[model samples]
Target: MLTDNQRGGIIAGYYLGHSCRAIAKVVGCHHSSVMSWPPAID
Candidate 1:
């Protein structure tokens, strides 16, 4: 599971127009995880 901070980072990164792959790299998760985040997050 992602930490609260990581979740926030993911959301922020997405909103900031960063690619899922790029966000995943910074968040230490797989790119697929980032691609799957939107439904789970917002």
Candidate 2:
């Protein structure tokens, strides 16, 4: 599971037009991690 910071970073990255890999890099996680964000966010 992701920490609060990771979850928030992914959301911010998505809104900022960052790619999955880029979001992972910024959030200090793997690209697959972005795929697991809360379903409500999708």
What is the number of backbone collisions in each predicted candidate, taken in the order shown? 0, 0
Off by over 4 Å in 2: 18-42
Q: Give the per-residue lDDT digits (tens) of candidate 1, residues 4-24.
A: 999898878666444665667
TM-score of each: 0.40, 0.40
Model 1: residues >4 Å from true position, as ranges? 18-42
Residue 25, model 2: Cα distance from true site in angstroms: 25
Which has the greatest lDDT? 1
Clashing pairs in 2: none
lDDT per residue as tens, model 2, 1-42: 999999898778666444555667778776564555433454
